[model samples]
Target: MQSVADGSQSSEVPNVLGDFALHLSAQRGLSAHTVRAYTSDLEQLFLFAQGQGVESYAEMELSTLRGWLAEMASRQLSRSTVARRGAAARTFFEWAARTGRIEQDPAARLASPRQHKVLPTVLAVNSAATLMDAARDLAVEGGPADLRVWACVELIYATGARVGEIVDLDVRDVDLDQRSVRVLGKGDRERIVPFGVPAAAALRAWLERGRPALATWSTADALFVGQRGQRWGQRQVRDAVHRLSAIAGVDDVAPHDLRHSAATHLLQGGSDLRTVQEVLGHATLATTQRYTHVSAERLRSSYQLAHPRA
Candidate 1:
């Protein structure tokens, strides 16, 4: 082990950052998945640099960073994945520099890989309604899948929230009297999103008639519980959305599509961009503006359909 100025030690043969990452995760409150990814990414970089006779991160140069990027591209990694790796590297190096382990940050000037600006696809109002209707019918059957499926579809479209946010919701997060649900969005930011009467009705049905039947002693306070009495995860919500979309004749619909549908419909109903931003919990207004484009496209199609003159 080579001791560094920061009172830290690095393996002379390379590849030991995984243990450091676990330490950061277990002690520093980092998410487990994030810790795993960051550790794996950093370990790869360290090994590559070591293969070139560079002992520590401080010995890295701009060319070495670029070479790593080229290696990622050669492996057919997506632009977004490469970009995330770059970010991870930058974060790790910054921490190293701060702790005196590294004298300089090699990733400071590393440009983020340009990602494709793929716009999200959304369902039309009628199509969304059809999906909700299917969910309702399924739930009325009183099966566990039906109850969870109904709530997933209804709440997602109603609040336009990310699936993670919806799954993390507690029973008390919803306010029936106020017609709002409190959501803890990304970065632990809390926002209140209002749901319409239909969504409220669906939620009421699930809470009153459905949830109790599925509730168990170990069931957490989560608003959505699985058949095993665990809280619903993002994967479960995605599967439910996929099934409901198929029933509605839209097999490709995703959880995010409901978010798009909400924003588009809100704009079409004359809501302003700022209001949409707040409702969607967007940190920037620029993100909410995309819905305006979707709304404009819908308006053009409507105009073409109803126009008397050719």
Candidate 2:
């Protein structure tokens, strides 16, 4: 561990952080990305504590945790970011206390600023159709690369999966006959997500024409591949989505917007909350409830537009 005060390395802090990271991975089953985030948050907290002349985890106190949060706020970090850091601190202290690294959990009563729930941007139905149409035109005009882009967009709209999950897909993960794909979600949880006919057609075309052309010895079992015959990257997928959205005259839409649109569309199409939760592989129903708010807002807008009331 590096001292937060003068940038000198420490002995015990690093060892404890390593143990905590192992606990998160082996026991909690958090994804590597999530683990990395937590690790970074704790490291920052430790650095802040050290800067305040606190040297070890045992010296960590509620006031020290609060001071770290205050510093983050003083720097004008977003409420969500502060809240996340607070959560990381809380979890780390709890684990430390449980494992006898600390006599008591200092962060037990730690409070974080309430994060404002910002509604995610979603495409209108016609706009989504236009985006798909544009992608389809590209597929028809270009060769393998075009087909792969189209398939990726279609699957994203159909399944509401994260970009990470999309790029991690292997050939065996998709099942054309079942119209479903096995998605490895956060925490390495697996779920089968169904796709529409358009997505299915696009996938089949990519598998037959696009992927075959791109596949090399290095490609292995990747369902989607880049031009150089490697697994598709998240950046590439994001770029494709942005390009397609721009071509369709819908500016500023990212891959996550498509997922938001899918969830809102599902709710507007009469899908239940629990079902949507399952489909999106959300760990908690509360995480899925945001879409309901989106649906309600849309309904209010539609009512205001169409009704004769003044």
Candidate 3:
């Protein structure tokens, strides 16, 4: 835990935090990333309480939690960040009270600032075609690595999956005949997403020729492998997307951009919000509605460009 105060006043905080982390993982089935984030948030809260002379989990109070959030706000953090931290505090205190680590939940009434709904940047349909064409060209000339990159981009655009979901996929998770993949999302939720023909073609090539050339003993069941022939990580796929964007003469974009583009394009093509929500693995229909705003912005831009009424 990062400390604002010099000395450790109580060992009980760390013990309780460990238990809470296990609870988040084993009982709640939260993804590893979320578990780590909540743990880090609680660590900062514990340290902040220590600095204010509150020594242990049982000693934590609503005022100390409020002060911690106030201090973060004073630092001019984004509303989303501040809100997430506040939510983390609320979760922690509620859990503590439930587990007998605290006598009462301090954050029962905690409220986070509503996160701003900023429109995501998505590639134009023509620009996406340009990117895919460039990816295909590279795949034809280059080796297994090129095919892997090509398949990754195509599948992401087709399914609008998160980068973490793409990298976590095993070969068995994909069904070539059905043109679908089963993604295990946050909280271990699973959904089947259908991809288009372009994605299917790229995947078939990767599975047959590309992956075989790259496979090693350590590769196991992983769909995508790095140069070392092990499971490719999210960071590595992100780096690949960056490089692909550069070479294709497009705006620098991450795998997330492909996801955004896919969602927006689907909406532009008249897909319903509920269908997009299921494909994107969003927990709420509201989360998928953001792409409709993107589509509206694009339409307005086109109208403004072409309309002659002044």
Q: What is the C-alpha RMSD of each candidate to the true structure, in Å?
A: 4.7, 1.6, 2.4
* TM-score of structure candidate 1: 0.83
Worst 10 residues of 3 by lDDT: 1-10
Off by over 4 Å in 2: 1-8, 308-310
Q: lDDT scores for all predictions?
A: 0.80, 0.90, 0.88
Candidate 1 positional error at 6, Å = 24
Please give, for residues 1-310, the per-residue lDDT of candidate 3 as tens digits: 3352445445566677788889999998888988889888887888787789876767777788889989998999999988988988888888988977778998998777898888887998888998998899999999999999999999999999999999999999999999999999988889999999999999999998899988788877999998888899999999998999999999988999999999999988989999999999998998888887888887898899999971
- Highest lDDT model number: 2
Q: Spell out the clash pairs found in candidate 3.
A: none
For candidate 1, the per-residue lDDT at 110 reads 87
User: What residue runs in model 3 are displaced by over 4 Å at the alpha carbon?
Assistant: 1-11, 308-310
lDDT for each residue of candidate 1 in 194-244, tens digit (9 for 90 to 100): 998878888888888778777777765878888777887899888878877
Order the numbered candidates by lDDT, best leading. 2, 3, 1
The better-scoring model by lDDT among 1 and 2 is: 2
